[model samples]
Target: MKKAIIVGSAISVIGLMLVSCSSTPEATTTTTRQTTVTAAPPPPAQTTTTTTHMSGSGY
Candidate 1:
């Protein structure tokens, strides 16, 4: 009974080590996109002028 128990434990530890060393690393991926936007038109401009004349002195 003692020999059988020692053999079983050794076999279990070796199996765990083999399984841990056989694993492969994972891979990753990335994606990107571009977009364009249009600009709005400018507002209209206005101009106004006024003139006033007064006659009071002659020399």
Candidate 2:
């Protein structure tokens, strides 16, 4: 029982140390979590032209 208690405490301390040691850099961590999105602008208005030609002849 005593041995188990000592071992458990040691493991807990080691885990805490590892967690504290592995923090990500500020820039790197922020970039990975950042979300960037851009939407395309609307297309310019289109103009359509229609032409009609008519010929008149006596039938």
lDDT of 2 by residue, 5-58 (tens): 999999999999998888754554443456789889999999899889787986
Give all candidate RMSDs, comma-separated: 15.3, 8.8
Question: Which regions of candidate 2 deviate over 4 angstroms?
Answer: 24-59
Off by over 4 Å in 1: 24-59
Q: In model 2, which range of ten residues has the least summed lDDT? A: 24-33
Measured against the true structure, the TM-scores of the candidates, in listed sequence, are 0.40, 0.40
lDDT tens digits, residues 1-59, model 1?
A: 99999999999999999988777555657555677777776666666667678888986
6 in model 1: Cα distance from truth in Å? 0.5
Best by lDDT: 2
Cα error, residue 41 of model 2, in Å, equals 46
TM-score of 2: 0.40
